[model samples]
Target: MTHPHRTSDPGVRARFLLAATAWTVLVAAVLVAVPLTFAGRLPDPVASHWGPSGRPDRSMPAAALTLFALVWLVVAGTGLVGLARARGEIRRATRAWFAAGLGWIGGFLIGIQAVTIAANLDRDGWSRAASLSWQVAVVVVGAFVLGALGRLAGRLGPDDAPPERERPGPLIDLDPGRRPVWVSTATAPWAVGLGVVASAAALSFAAAALWGLAPAGWSTALPLALAGVVGLAVSSVSVRIAPEGLTMAFGPLRWPSRTVRLDRIERAWVEWRSPVQVGGWGIRGLPGRATIMIRGGECLVVRYTSGGQLAVSVDDAETGAALLNALAARKTA
Candidate 1:
C-alpha cells in the first residue's frame, strides 16, 4: 500500500527474497523426492516422451531421467540466482515474474512426475502417462502464483529521487514565446517489417501444429501466443510530446501508453546508441529507463525526476528532445 516514489522498503525486499527461496526450495525438494521415493518402483526405462494425445510414446533409462532432472535443477537454480543478483533491469515487477515462471515450470514438472508415478503404480512394461489435464492445471496454478507474488513485490523503490538543484535550461536556441505547441511523430518501418515476418512464422508454425504436421499442445501454442503479442507491440507505434509529457503507445489504444510526466522530467537530449549500449533492440532495457531501439540510430533521451532515463530512436531526435526540454523547462520554471 505504501508505494515509495523511488525508495524501496525492507518489507518488500524481504518478501521478494522469501518468494525466491520458496521457489528454489520447492523445486529442489521435488527433484530429490521424486526419484528417491519411486526409484525402485518405477520401470527401469520409464516412459518419457509424450505425444499430441498427451500419452507416453517413448522411454528413457532411469539414469538418463536422473540426468534430465539434474539439468532442470541447474538451469532453474541458475536463472533464479541471476535474476536476484542482477539490478536495474530485473526490478521488483520483473523479478516477481521470473520467480513465478520458475514456480510454474517447477510445479509443472513435479505434476508430471506425480502423474507418472500414479500411472505406473501397477504397470509392467511401459507406464501409461496421464492426460494433459495436469499440464493445464499446472499452468493455471502458475498464473495464480504469479499474480499473487507480483502484487506482493510492490512498486519500484522510492530511493531514486530527483536532485534539488534545477538543471540548466534547454539548448534549443529558440525563443519560448515564438514556439507554438510543437509536435513530432513517426512510424518505425523496421519494427513493422519485423512484426510482419514474425507473424508469418507464427502462422506457419500454428498451421503445422493444428494440421498434425507437428505436435499440437502447450509447447506449440505458447510461442504462437507470444508472437501475436510481439506483433501488436511492434506493428504500430506513435510518439507524442505534449504539456502532460512525452507519450508512446501502440496504435490508438493509449490507456497503457508509456509516459514521462512533465514534472518528473529533469532534462532532455539527443544521443546515438546500439545494442551494445542498451542491451538489445525492440523495446529493450530496464523498467524505469528503457531503450526503444527500433532501427537504432539517433535517440531522444529524457532524464526524469527519479534519476531514471529512457531513450527512443526516431528521425529528427534532436528536434524532439529540444521540444521536450523546452516544455519541461517552462513547467519547472
Candidate 2:
C-alpha cells in the first residue's frame, strides 16, 4: 500500500533496486503457479457463452488481470529508474512513461489478436495480415513507451529542480551558460480535445465488442473511432524563453500557430479564461481575442508594450505573469 519514494543516492538506489527485483521475482512466481494450478478449470477465453450450459464466462478476465499485473510490474521498475536519474524533469518522464505504457499494452493486446489472425491466413486472410502488422506495431510501442514515460515523469514537478532539491523552478539559477528557457502548458482546449477523442474511442470499442453481436453492421464505425485516437494524439507544447519568444505547436501536422515576443509587451494581466469564452471544449476554433488553459485555473495574458497580446495557460498564471513583469521590469528599471 505504500508508494515508492524515488532516491538517486548510490546507496539508496542500490537498496531500492534489490528490493524491487526481489518483489518482482516473488510476484512472477505467484503468477506462474496460480495459472498452472487452474489451467483448464476454465474454457478458452475467446469463447463467449450465453446459455446456462456453456462454461459460464468468468475465467478469462481473471487470467487477463494476472497478465496485466505482470506487465505493470515490469513497467513500474523501469519507471523507478527514470525517477532516479531524471533530476530535473521527473514529471515529464513520468507522463511519457504512462503514455508509452498504455500505447504498448494496447499494441500488445491488439498484436496478440493479430498474430492469431495471421496464423489462419487461408482461413482469415485479411484479418491475419492485419494482425501481423498490429503485432509489430505493438512490440515497437512497448519498447519505446518506457523511454517516453521517463521523460514525462521527470517533468512532473517544478521546471528544473532536481528530485532531491527543495521546490522546483520558476526562478532560474543565473548562469550565462544556460540560454533561453522554453515551457508550455498542457492547456484546457488541448485537454478537452483529447478527452473527447479518447472517450469516443473507448466507448465505441466497448459498445462494439460487448453489445454488438453482428459483424457486418458494426463494421462501419471504425473510421470515426480511429479519428478520436488521432485527435487525442494532438497536443500543444509551448517553448518560450527570455530570447526565444513564444511558439505554440498544435500537432505533428502543423507548425507553430501563435507567437508573442518578449519586448513588445507594455503590460500584462493574469486571469482565468472561462470555457464559455473559448466556445466550450476542444481547440477547433480560436475562442476569443485572448485565451489559454491547463494551469491551476488561470493564464498569463501579456500585452505587448509595442504590439498585440499573448494568452498562455501556465501552472501559476499570477506567478508567471509576475515573473514576466519582473523580467521586463528589470530590463526597463
Candidate 3:
C-alpha cells in the first residue's frame, strides 16, 4: 500500500551520492600519489600491524600495499551503494558517517605508510621518530573527520510522522468481559539462514586448522562468536498486550524488553509491509516508526499521540490489532 505522506526528496539522494563519491576520490588520490612521491625511499616489507602496546607486530611487503588500498576503495564503493538505498533517517545520517569512516581509513593508511617509509629510508626497521607514535596523529585526524561529517549530516533523529493511511473498515471487536491480556510469538526464516552460514564458517575454519593453516587464537574466538550468532538466530520473540500497554521479550532469557502505555496510542490497525518500509526487520526504529518484525506478513500497527508509529509482526495480528483499538478507545473515552 502507498503511504499517504511520504517524502521522496531527490536532493537527499544527491547529497548522499556526492558525499560518497568525493570521499572515494580523495582516498584513491592519497593511495596513488603518496607512494609515487616517495618512490624507492621506503623499505621492501613495512610495518603494517600494531599490537596493544602500540608497537609494530606484523609487516607486509611494500609492493602488496596496493592490495590494501584497493580493498578500502572497494569497501567505500560498496558501502556507498548500500547506504544510499537506505530509507528514512537511516539514509541521511549513516551515509555521511560512513563516508567519514572511509576518509579516516584512508588517512590512517597514508599516515602509517609515510611514517614507515621515512623511518625505513636509512634502515630496515623503524627509526626512533617513525615508531607507533604516528597512531596519535591518525586518531586525532579521524576524530575530526567524524565530527565534520556528523555536523554536515545535521540531526539524525527519525521523522515525527511516517507515511501511513487509515484503514477504511471498522476494527475487530473483542469481548468486553474477557481478560485483557494477549500473547503472541514470532519467528524469522532469515535468522535460520544466518545461523546456517555462521555454523558453516566455524566448521570451515576448524577444518582448515586440522590441516595446520588456521590462526591459533581463531580456534576459540571464532567458535564463541559463531555460537552467539546461532543463539540469537534461533531465539523467538514474545509479545503481550494488556490494559497497561504492550510488552515485548526475546527468548527464554528475555534479556531485552520494552513496554508502551495504552494511553499513548491514538490509532491501531492491521497492516502488511515489506522490509523496505521499516529498514529490513528486527527491532528497527526510525524517527516516527518503530518496527519489531520477525517475518514480513500481517502486523499490528499503532500510531502514538506523539506522532510516532510502532508495529509488531506476528501471528493472529488481526486479534491483536482489534484488542489494541478497543483498549485504546476505552482509555480515550
Candidate topping TM-score: 3
Candidate-wise lDDT, in order: 0.63, 0.45, 0.66
TM-score of each: 0.47, 0.34, 0.58
lDDT of 3 by residue, 60-81 (tens): 7767656656876787776665
lDDT of 2: 0.45
Least accurate 10 contiguous residues by lDDT in model 3:
154-163
Mind sharing the TM-score for model 1? 0.47
Write one digit per residue (lDDT tens) for candidate 1, span 1-333: 665454545555556666667766766777667776787777767776667787778887755544536766786776655444443333454544555556566665665566556655445656554444466576567656755654454343433343465444345644656643444544556556656676677777777788888775447557766775665575445678877888876632432577767898888877666543454456787787788765445777788889887888767777777778778767767
Which stretches in model 1 have alpha-carbon errors above 4 Å?
1-7, 10-15, 52-54, 67-71, 87-91, 127-282, 285-309, 312-333
Q: Which tens-of-lDDT digit does each residue in 156-264 have in candidate 2?
A: 3333223342112133333445554545455445544764766575566657666665344345446655665555434444535454354565544335466556566
- RMSD to the true structure for each prediction, in A, is 9.2, 15.3, 6.9
User: Which pairs, if any, clash in model 3?
Assistant: 158-287, 159-287
For candidate 1, the 10 contiguous residues with the lowest summed lDDT are 154-163
Give candidate 3's root-mean-square deviation (CA, Å): 6.9
Score residue 38 of candidate 1 by CA lDDT. Answer: 81
